[model samples]
Target chain A: MKQDSESIQKMMIILSKGTLENVYAAFVLANGARMEGINADVFFTFFGLEAIHKKKLEHLHVATVGNPAMHIPTMIGGLPGMEALATSMMKKEMEKIDMPDILEFLEILTASGVKLWACKLAMDMFHYKKEDLYEGVEDIITVGDFYNKSQGPGTHILFI
Target chain B: MERTIAGNTISLNEEGYMTNFSQWTEEVGKELATEAEINMTPRHWEVIKYLQKEHQDQVALSIRRIGKSGVVDIKEFYQLFPLAPLKTATKIAGIPKPASCI
Candidate 1:
C-alpha cells in the first residue's frame, strides 16, 4: 500500500436541509476541501434541492424556530417575517466576512471544479426539471450511482 | 526557521511559508515555485505580482476576491496553479497562506 493511503483523497458531501446555515455549511466544507487539493462533490437531496433551485436559492432563510442557536423563543421565531429578518442580518454578517452570496457562490464552486449532483428521487418528488436547477449542477443521479462514483479508498461520504 | 534560497537566508514558518515578505524577489520566487513543482512563466508571474500587490495593500485574499481581481478569473487561476491554487500561489508569491475557506 502507498504510505499516504490514510490521507483523505476526496469528500462526498450530502446536503438534505434547505436552511441557509446548513446550505452554507455544506458549501464551505466542499469548497474548503477543494482549497486543500482534495476532490469534493456535493449531493443535494430533499429540501436541499432548494439550494440549486434558481428561483429559490437567493431566497433561502436561516431556520429560527427549532434552532436553539438563534437564542430566540420558539414562538417569537415563528412569527411572520422573523426568518427573513434573521436571514438578512446573517447575510450582512456573511458579506462582511467576504462570504459570497448564493448565486455567486454556486458560480465559484463550479469554477473551482467541485462537481454538484442532485438526487434523482428528490427531483421526482419535487417535480423539478433539469432546467429548474442552477446551470452549474452536473446532473441528477441515483443513490446507487453516487456510491459508484464514490469508489476507491480514502473517499469519504458526509451527510449534512 | 531560517533557510537559504537563492543564496540568501530567509525565515519561514512551520508550513514553509516565508515569514518576511521583504526577503522575497523574483529569484526567490522562482526557487519557491520549483520547490512546489511549478514552472514560472509570464502568466504565473502576473498572478504572483497580483498576489504580492494584494498582500502589500492588506487585502485579505480569497478565491472569491481573486476571481473578481480581473487579473485572473477563478478558472484561469486554477489552470495557472492547479491543486490548491490559493495555497500554492500564495506560497510561491512568498505571502502567508490565506485563511479563507472559500
Candidate 2:
C-alpha cells in the first residue's frame, strides 16, 4: 500500500533497551524527525522501560555484559561498582560534548513535540506504577495499541 | 570555494554552505538559490529570512519550528524547497546547516 503526499506524516521509534546510549540515540532521532516537520513518537518496552522510570532515569548505565566494546569478560560486568563506574564515565563523556543528561534530554524531546509511550506489558512485568514513570509519558499502552496508533501512510517505524 | 555575487565574495564550505553569515545579502541568496536550481520567490525569501534571524539568535531551526514561527506553513515550506528542505533552505539562506539536520 502507498500513501499520497498528505498521508505521510508520522515517524515511530521503538526503544526496547534501557542502555544510556540507546535512549540518547532515540531522542536524538526523534528530535530530528520532529524538527523536520514530521510527527515523532517513541515507545518504551522491555528493558527500555527503565528509561522512563523516575528514579532509574537519572542513573542509567551502559550494559557492559554482551557489549562488544567492553572487551572484559561478561561475568565481570556483574561485579559491584562496575556499572556505577561505567555510568559515571559515560556521563562525563557526554558532558564534554555538551550533551544533556537523560532527564534533560527527555524534557527537550517532549518540549519539541515528540510523544513518549510506555508499554503496558513491560510495565506490569517490571511491577511499575504510573506514578513511577517520568513526566512526559503520554500513556501506558500495549504493543497492539502501538501498532494501531502507528498505522497510516508514510509511517516509519524503527526498532532501536 | 567562493562565489562572488554583486561585488561581494561569499565563502562556502566544501559542501557549499555559507561560512560567513555577515556576507549574506538578498543578491547572494538569489545566486545560491539559482545554483541549487530553485526559483527564488517571495515565499522562499520568507523562509530564508526567518532562518537567518534564527541563526543569529543561535536557535536550533527545524521545519516544525519554522512552520510554527508563522513565516510559512510546513507544506508550503516543503513545496518551495522540495528536496531536503532544511538543508537546501539553510544553504540558500546563507546560514549554517541546522544542528538537527546534521
Candidate 3:
C-alpha cells in the first residue's frame, strides 16, 4: 500500500534510572510521541529498576538533593527549611500541570502500546525476578541488545 | 491578513463536546489551543488533523520485537508534527500514559 504523504517517525528511549525524575521524564516523552502518533519504547535498568518494581514503582519519589530546580522555593522564601518547602513545592508544580502520578502515567502509556523493559543484569544483581516486575514489562536485555533495537536510522534514543 | 467571525454563533448542550463551530466562541478555540498546547494556528490545525488520523489507523508497524505483546511503534511523528506536544498534550487530551514509560 502507498504510504500517506505524511507519517510520524519511530523512536526508542532507554531509561537507566527508575527514580520519579527519570521515569516521569521517559513517560512524558513517550506520551508526547504517542500524541503525535510516533512509536516509543523505554528500556529500564540500574537504579532505574525501582520504577518498574511492583512494590516500589508507585512510590518512586523524586531526588530532592542536588536536583537543579529543587532550589525554587529557597529562592522565593529565603534559605530556611528549603528542603521541606521544596518537596511541597514540587508536588504543587506537578498538579498545576496535572501530570498523573507515577502509576497512572504508566497505566496510560502501557495501554497505548509503549514497550516497557527490565534489564536482565540489573534484575539478577538486585535479586529481582520476573515476578518482581509489574504487569507490562518486556524482557530485560543488556546494553548491546537494547542498542540493536534502537539502531534504526529513524530511531530516537533518550537516556532518562 | 484577518478573517471576521461572519456573524455566526454555535450552541452546545450540557456536555462540553462541541455542538457546533458556528456557535463556538474564540474562547473555545483558545481553550482547545491551551489544552492541546498548540498555538491553534492554521499551521497547527493541519498537523493536529494528521495526528488524529494516524492515531486512528491500524496499519502494520516495523518495530523490533520486544515485549511478549510486541509493542507497536506508531512512528512518523516528530518530522510530520513539529509543534506537537509530547508530555503536555497527553494531559489535555485525557489519554492514559504509555506502559513502557510506566
Clash pairs for candidate 1? none
Worst 10 residues of 2 chain A by lDDT: A1-10
Q: Which candidate tops lDDT?
A: 1
Order by lDDT, highest first: 1, 2, 3
Question: A8-112 in candidate 1: lDDT tens per residue?
Answer: 889999999999999999999999988888889999999999999999999999999999989989999999999999999999999999999989999999999
Compared with the true structure, all predictions reach lDDT values of: 0.94, 0.82, 0.56
Report per-candidate DockQ.
0.64, 0.13, 0.10
Q: Summarize candidate 2's per-residue lDDT along A1-160 as a digit string, tens digits.
A: 1236665478899999888889888887886775565778999999888999998988788887888697768899888888888888888987766577788778767755678999999999999999999988999998899999998778989999
What CAPRI class is candidate 3?
A: incorrect
Best by TM-score: 1
Model 1: DockQ vs. true structure: 0.64
Residue B83 local lDDT, model 2: 53
TM-score of chain B of 1: 0.98
